[model samples]
Target: MEFRLLGQFELRDGDRGHHLGGPMQRTLLAHLLLAGQAVRTTDDLTRRLWGTADSSTSTLQVHVLRLRRLLKATGCSATIETSPGGYRVNLGDDTADVTEFHRHIASARNTDDEVRELHALDAALDLWRGTPLTGVTADWPRFPEVRALTEARDEARTRRAELRMTLGRSPDLQDLRDLIAEHPEREHTRHLLMWALHRAGRRKEALATYEDAYRYSVGQLGLEPCRQLRELQHLVLSGG
Candidate 1:
């Protein structure tokens, strides 16, 4: 069984496709796929399906049952196990698109393959079509996958910045400058911009950029600029 939540939500068990009919069904399936191999209680699923409001447990069970039947019909033999207090969709027989995506990214990072990493990052970024939970408000808060994806996107951006700087590519400075302007609170972006400026012989501008980054970090996040940035500032002053 293969599940795709990137680009579109789709499930394929063997050669047959599982067509989950309603928004609720999609949400349920999404939660299950994102949860990995963990057992999610009925109450947990119910809260994600229907917030602090009235909802029938039987109704949720009905949805789960229907989803199970749909998976079975699609040729997935792995069962959605129901225990006394909870249920878990066994992932041993299933593959998630998001999981595959992260795996590819991790591989790229490990091998230091900048070209492959950039391509995979772009593909992963494109996978987000809209707000994660779109029509499912109950599932909005405390969704770890949503946070994970956000962090992944940021990580991709940072990696791209590092690669461009290391390549001694000057034209890439404008893009990084724009990124810093847009995300003034991001010290990582500022650090890259500073490095780009210094490497391009714009020493005064680079120092000024560091000052700005320090001020922004202190004012907005109530934190000092990171050690790397501070060290870079000192190195620049000493004519490094």
Candidate 2:
């Protein structure tokens, strides 16, 4: 059984996809999975499911029971185990996409082989179908855990773009443009975009990109661009 949380919340059993339950149930399972082996207490689960005031202990128990039954019906080896504190879904050797993504990225960072690193990074980035934890509502995206995961995803993307540039591949200009539009405040991405443009023989546009980033940082952020970004600007200017 494979639990995929990097994209849509889905359970896969050897080529067949199993639906966990409705939106709420899917959100519940996501909360547990995001905990990643740490037991989420009843209080925490309740708040996550239906906020602090609206959630009932009995309601939570009912949902947990339903989720457990659904998992059982799928014939997966994984199970949601109840403990004194709360409940935990033990994956038990079955991998989650999020876990696999992190594992690949760690390998990429550790390996000295650029080819191996690129492959690992490619595998890591491929785990994301759309956004991290798509479809589920109920404040899951607002959770600190989800925020950290999103940050990791973004970092992986930036790393992959950097690696592709190093490998002399023509960078995905439109993808980089979209990323810049999404995260205008992220200077590293702007730096990568500038490099991509320059590598494509668009030095004039590359220098203009740096100027735009510099203005955005100084205007919106009330700060100067970071050292790396400044160095890149200088490199572009010096025809390096």
Candidate 3:
């Protein structure tokens, strides 16, 4: 069984996919999955689900029951185990996309072989179907786990672009431009975009990109550009 939480929440048994249920139910499962093997107390879950810990324990139990039933219906061997403190979903050897993504990223980071690392990075990035936790709401994005996952995704993307440039492959300029436009605060992406422009012999545009980022950082963020970005600006200016 494969649990896909990278985009939409889904459970796949063989070739067919099973729905995890409606938004609230999906939200419950998402929280449990994000918790991994750790027990999430009823109080913690209730607060996450309902914005307060005052929600009835029975309400949480109902959702867990439905999730267990859905797992059984899908023929997934995974189980939702109840402990003294709270509930946890045991995935056993089953795979979750987010977990797999991190594993691949770790392998990529650990490997000395650039070719192997690039392959790992490619596999890591391919797991994303869309935004992590696409449909399910219940304040999912507000969770610390989700925020960390989002940051990891952004780092993976930036690393891939940097690796491609290092390997003498020009990254898609339009894509870099769009990424900068989408995430203006992402200094890493901005730095890469500037580097890509410089590598493409568009030196003036590279300098302009850095200037724009510098202004955005200082004017909006009330901070100066990082040292690496400033050095890149100097390199462009000195015709390096």
Q: Write the per-residue lDDT of candidate 2 for residues 53-163, one digit (tens) a residue.
A: 356789988999999898888888778889786998798867798878778989998999987898898898888888777777766567898888877877777877888
Which residue segments of model 3 deviate by more than 4 Å?
A: 172-175, 221-239
RMSD of each: 5.2, 2.5, 2.5
TM value for model 3: 0.86
Q: Model-by-model lDDT, in order?
A: 0.73, 0.84, 0.86
| Candidate 1 segments whose C-alpha is farther than 4 A from its true place | 6-19, 52-56, 72-79, 90-94, 105-141, 163-184, 197-215, 218-240
Q: How many backbone clashes does candidate 3 have?
A: 0
Worst 10 residues of 1 by lDDT: 132-141
Question: Could you tell which candidate, 2 or 3, scores higher by TM-score?
Answer: 2
- What digit string (tens of lDDT, one per residue) describes model 3 on residues 49-119? 99899999998999899988887877777889998879998997688888898899999999988778878
Per-model TM-score on C-alpha atoms? 0.64, 0.86, 0.86
Residue 150, model 2: Cα distance from true site in angstroms:
0.6
Ordered by lDDT, highest first, the candidates read 3, 2, 1
lDDT of candidate model 2 versus the reference: 0.84
Kindly report which residue pairs in candidate 1 clash with one another. none
Predicted structure 3: lDDT = 0.86
Model 2 alpha-carbon drift over 4 Å, by segment:
53-55, 222-238
Instruction: List pairs with backbone clashes in candidate 2.
Output: none
lDDT of 3 at 84: 86
